[model samples]
Target: MTAADGVAATVDLNGNFPASPPGSRSKKMVRDGPQPPADPTAVGVKKSGVLWADLDPCDEGRAPTVNGGHADTASGANGANGANGANGANGHHAGHDDGAPDGVPAASDRIDGVLEMLETHPESRVLVLYTGGTIGMVRDQSGALAPLRNRLASRLRSSPTFHDQEYAKRRFGDSDTGPLILPVSSEGRRVLYTIREYDPLLDSSCMGIEDWVRIATDIKAHYEQYDGFLVLHGTDTLAYTSSALSFMLENLGKSVIVTGSQIPLWELRSDGRDNLLVSLLLAGCYVIPEVTVMFGARLLRGNRTVKVSADSLRAFDSPNFPPLATIGINIDVDYRLLHRPKATEPFKVHCKMGSNVGVLRIFPNIPTTAIQSFLAPPLKGAVLQTYGAGNIPGNRVDLLEALREAADRGVILVNCTQCTHGRVAEVYAMGKVLWDIGVVAGADMTPEAALSKLSYVLSKDEWDLATKKEMLRCSLRGELTAPARVLADWDDLDAVVRALGAKPSQTASLLVPAVTCAAAARRGAGPLQAVIDAGADPAAATMEGRTPLHVAAYEGNLEAVRLLLRHGAGVHAKDRFGRTPLVDAVQMDRHEVIAALRGSGAHLGAANPALGDKLCSVAAVGDVQRLESYRLAGTDLCQRDTCGRTPLHVAAQMGRSAAALFLVSSGVDVAAKDLSGLTPAELASAAGHHALANALRSRRSNFCT
Candidate 1:
């Protein structure tokens, strides 16, 4: 017998195709309180509305069929593990009686025999995440395709290319609603995939942060249970979703391939058939340990991908980065390009992503107020799409100042280029000005990756501003490639590195600073050294995190700071918080460390927020020795907290007469008033430190005289 006929023999088709797919829901997708009677051909006797076909069991020693026939009560394939019609949104018929025996179930119910996630199997088991898209679409009453539910599953089950009836019958008997196992491939690979369709399928253009989080969270929930995942998504926002997933699922060790088609699967010549077919193989038959986009004939790094055409079959590409794999006559995976996570490291999925970030594309004569308002409050970060090579108009001083103010306010602004296929370089004067004003060069990242990475960085409550800025510029995933031209925008070390990359007349030490700030955020000598030795730009090094120099100074790693400095790390490098190593050193009065950084030509960070936190804390606790140390470090001794309480204000309020004496003797404002309009002496009086209040008032009067 032919394969098609052999496959058709397992189930019964009565030529009674429904106006809609069986188990289809209404436009609202609302569940009915009381369901309708059963359709005779459906595997579930209780399933109502309409039936595409009836699934039957084998002969005497086998399972039963649901076609006005006796039940295979011993096998019980359709008894509990049968088709459900609760979603049969078509209301019940008045007089049409469904043909069923007296003891058979007549009300709609869900199939209760789902495969467990933790179930063991030798074959590759994939969770087919059927989110609403072209691949899972069907024609409604108006002949317009919309996101479908069980129809795609039904199509796969009915197609011999997708399911092996004999194999499934031997394995799961008459329960066709369980895992849909595919026929063995020529390479001896068989895939067992289960469909987990999303309720009220989402459209391609409507996906957002919360939707991306939902997809990632689902993958995490079934992470250990499945070998891989295949996401059927709409084509429009597919790239954004993929890029967002790449950031949301950190340290991922399994494959997450997002795929969709231009034409709906319900169409006669649908591209979704091939897209879904190949995506399934890539997800289940291979091990690519990173989030990826699989479409047309290429598998690309998720963060590096961009949609190339709106209607072409070959729709996506990783313009800057090469495809991880190519599928033509044979699937050719570039094994070297795959991200290999350490086996010992547990995979973590970041569920929380801040949504305060936005994208701003720069154009000629764009209003300064426009950018100011766009980058204003509620926007903590932004992806600035600039002119070629990351340039801003040098003549727009107002624009420059507005951006500078935003950066100063701790808004992370990442600079990405407007071109489709090149890295952002700081070759122009204005580009350098952007770097100087604290705009992070986004290198070659797509706008999707840049914005998502920005949100991810800002959501990290533990990382300081310095760390966030450093991370925004670095490669956390394979999203961007920092070209050598970026060196010119950095310090002396990077300029030298940039020149050396051209094989200049003279050569400096190959040991210029490189590596993500997140990796060696604590030490400059260990992880930073290792990555630098492996040819990382010590100054530009990042692993989707902060710079090593930023971290070394923040953690008071005196020797690490020295190590980085001795190796030509940028002494003037600022963290996302705009604090230079010198500023961090001055914050804690790291005397010898400050001297070392200053000796290396480091300057104080401007408008730095790490200004007076340490001073206030020490003064509040009456740590006289620490206060003395800050005075020697050249601290202004006048920095205020959020409430406008200066160090002297804190000292007076805490009633530390000794601390107050040190501050007043250091030429501090003895009569400094707080936000409450209460002077230092008044604060001391209010707190019942009457003796200290008198002493402070005497000191203030002496100063006035």
Candidate 2:
């Protein structure tokens, strides 16, 4: 199928393409015409289509007529109406000059017309390698969809959904050479991309180790020219390709996204648009240096993914690991979870891949002969999917003997769990038996990661067996979590302290917040008593001036409060907010803690005469009655703290909805700005309190009226 045929099929599927009005040239003529002029006035105007009036800026009263006719310069005369133009080839209204009077161009004109504006802006260059995928599939003469070679670029250029004429008009001319340029605006920068489609594209199911090597080699060739890359592929084996690429590319310092869709782009309800658009944007804009799979609004580490469903749109998941990023109204990236590449390391590719690895799933009633046949010669490594927690039936001595024989024959066997989650460890007696027989534990690694890593390891001919075993246990490319330290004996608490990087005598000097210690008490009495018995100070205060007693009282931790008081913790201590333990307990409605604090001689109200701190404290704890009392006492309603946060700001930021409602009812300034110039409503929105923010906005509007 030709590219034009693909585009025509898409247009027929949608039935959205409008015909040209009378006297206008055909859509084909627009594409064949000379390139539009560089001037902003002529940039988005389709010369063969509608005739539009270009309003005069100097003489605002007059509007220019169609066909280059002039109107009255001073009478503010209206010109004769021209035929309405059909939608432009780029999916924008052509020659509609409504915005010409205000000096702001129409949406269609702004598509690629922003080139001059982008001259001073930074550009992120992306290279998209379009391999065969559903995104590039087109129907043939018999109406069956298939991969079309040399048609992807043409289809993209002709489709308004992919190519915005205005955006195309803004290309940085005479500066570079490559395929199609796609413009994307994100994060205050312009992303320009070039698409390079592969010849005789192979389906993802047919993709192999050699194909992975080819992809890696291509990236290595163009590494210096582009900032990032996007690979369009079939979804059947997308996860495998991503995994292979992850290991094949070493010390990669740029983002490489593997993405495809289940639906073809020529369909009306296709998911290809969002998937391709987001992949392009992320590739061009972000600095994530790992091979990742972008699908179903998630950015997952490629090696950790598995195809969980064949029919669902959300077909892939990283069961053992959380996604690195999630896409919503905003793109939320967990930077702490992302692996940061060292600046000193240079990018390289390891093209050699071992293909002799296999997977064996253990099941009940399995014959010993079957196991031996599978583990026969030529299998360099195998991933044994053992029962829960890496356990095989110990009573099946014959099966165990076959595995032992395989190991004795120098075959590397990795033990992973059949379950989607949890780690394989020597918790069971059967597990210990496998461990004793030279089976390596694939701790918390998904099957995909285990198999891929095994192949990658066996391919390294220079490395010895011991080195490969050690590397298997260690985390090498963020593929697996390192094995945790097993401190079997806790008889010596001092040793535990030393292991935690603290001296026995200095244990009490631990600077962890007292509130955190109080929260930790909920886990068990053992950890709390260990800290206390190790000479930990019960009166330690965080930088916020909150003591263990204050946090205990607020959290209603009765035993923790008793322990702190018995250990010489002060009763009259005040926080930096001028709040006492009694105040915190009372505001939190912890009746037991309130009684205990009162018995310890704690007092209520602020520790000082600062009205801002007192009001903010009351609002933070939802003490509506106390706030009302302060308002009745003639205290400033809009008082601000040292941080310039008003009581309303405090209530909104802390999600104290009732307190915010009370303050609003008391006629407080809802529009009062904080130190950062955000109003209470904006603070609530930033804090993710949508209901509170909406209420505040509604109240502010009512007050303004």
Task: Give each model a TM-score.
Answer: 0.54, 0.53
Lowest lDDT 10-mer window, candidate 2?
A: 53-62
**Candidate 2 segments exceeding 4 Å error:** 1-116, 172-184, 483-705
Q: Which 10-residue span in candidate 1 carries the lowest summed lDDT?
A: 52-61
Query: In model 2, what are the clashing residue pairs, if there are any?
Result: 111-166, 111-167, 112-166, 112-167
Q: How would you encode candidate 2's per-residue C-alpha lDDT over 389-431 as one tens digit per residue?
A: 9999989999889999999988899999999878898999999
What ranges in model 1 sit over 4 Å off? 1-122, 342-344, 482-705
Q: lDDT values of the candidates? A: 0.62, 0.62
lDDT of 1: 0.62
Q: CA lDDT of 419 in candidate 2?
A: 95
- What local lDDT score does residue 376 receive in model 1, on the 0 to 100 scale? 88
